[model samples]
Target: MSLPPWISEQLPENGRVNTKLTQRHVVETMYQSDRPFFSLQQIQQRLKPDVSKVTVRNRLDDLEDRGIVATDPLADSLTLYYIDHPESEWPLSPAGERALNRESAETGNPFREFLQHPLVNRVFREELLRSIAWAAIGLFGWAILVSSSGQLPATIWTVVGLPILTWASLTVGTIGVRLMTGNNLRVQSTEGLDTISLGGVVLGGFWAVFLIVVLDWSPLVTSGLYLFVTATYLVFYKRVIRPRFDASVED
Candidate 1:
């Protein structure tokens, strides 16, 4: 029942941390655990000396009172707790839902809020695997087509057409999915596309083009490298950036 090293590392080494931090750790442990629910003693054991049993109990009561965690009382009178999702069987109260949304928006990171949106979650949850498969297939076909074409034209297309097509497809396709699902398309935050991010997007396209056309690299090789970089970024985001997001909750 020991806490994971990553979770423990984020906490203080000395006396008690604040209740909200304790709550976040409790939520994070449940998130990382394979088990869906943990009893009070089980949660206390996992958290150990970093958070006292009394503090864990208080936080659990607060989370339950706020409807952020659902509970089941056993015949033995032990209560089990699990973090509540929006679609959980025991629905979150209107106030709970509002508070969750407010906390996310308060982070001032639109991309984060976009990730938290229920509609976005619903779309990705159902379609992500399928879309990934199709994307791979499409990329393979594009590589073959480019390989067979005239070198100059292929390079030009790879440099110009590919970026535009990719941008259009992702933007339109995401909006299309939401609209087709009978959901309103809400703009989460354009702040994500601030100068630095937009600059990176532009520079990335030019860099790929430079490698293919000026350096005389094959379109296939250039495209593959671009995809590899993209995949690496996604892996880094999921492994590193996401953990911080997961552990954060507004006090």
Candidate 2:
């Protein structure tokens, strides 16, 4: 398949024009095709059969290193490769280019680098809103239950603190889960959200029992503590942990 002119423009003029040409052909085939994922052999079969396996492997590695492609580890001991960015979007979209370039310069913080890209920021905001809505619903339901029992605290904490804490927890929890799973936040997926929701429910239930039934902390104190702890952790995550981890991972 013929590659786009822009693809060539994106590559460096480092006297590897032939290598770049071959890599461009592979990208074009993957981008233009309907298939979601391809094995190394499948990619080679589709390309000029004379191309050495080493060349194909090296090109695939290069694409992945550039964040243009991702690898999926399968259960059958075989790995599949596919474009990492959204299929509907071009791999070399302006936002992607900016992300790739920024990632190299901003080695200190991966999360910050991630937000610098418009597409990644958009996805993060959309998912964050969804998580906040879910948190609100959960808090509202809990409020209703406490009210029916006539044990609802007559304070702003129950009304305001709960929702805020839940929202923050869900958002942070989602990111933590993604980091644990080694999934890139740039490539949006629902699996992280699902995992967060399930974990939230279990943890929320335990927290409620401990705070209300066991410790019996006052509503105001609970709210103050929750806000303090959550804020502290978030600050640490954004300022310290994220940057440290981001620096550790290679681009």
Q: Best-fitting candidate, measured by TM-score? A: 2
Candidate 2: C-alpha lDDT:
0.62
Output the TM-score of candidate 1. 0.31
Clash counts for all predictions: 0, 0
Clashes of 2: 0
lDDT (Cα) of model 1 = 0.60
All candidates' TM-scores?
Answer: 0.31, 0.33
- Candidate 2 lDDT over residue span 56-108, tens digit each: 88888888776667788676767788776533343344455456646655665
Model 2: CA > 4 A from native: 1-112, 179-251
lDDT of candidate 1 over 126-165, digit per residue (tens): 4554456456545654565566567535676774566556
The prediction achieving the highest lDDT against the true structure is 2
RMSD of each: 15.4, 17.3
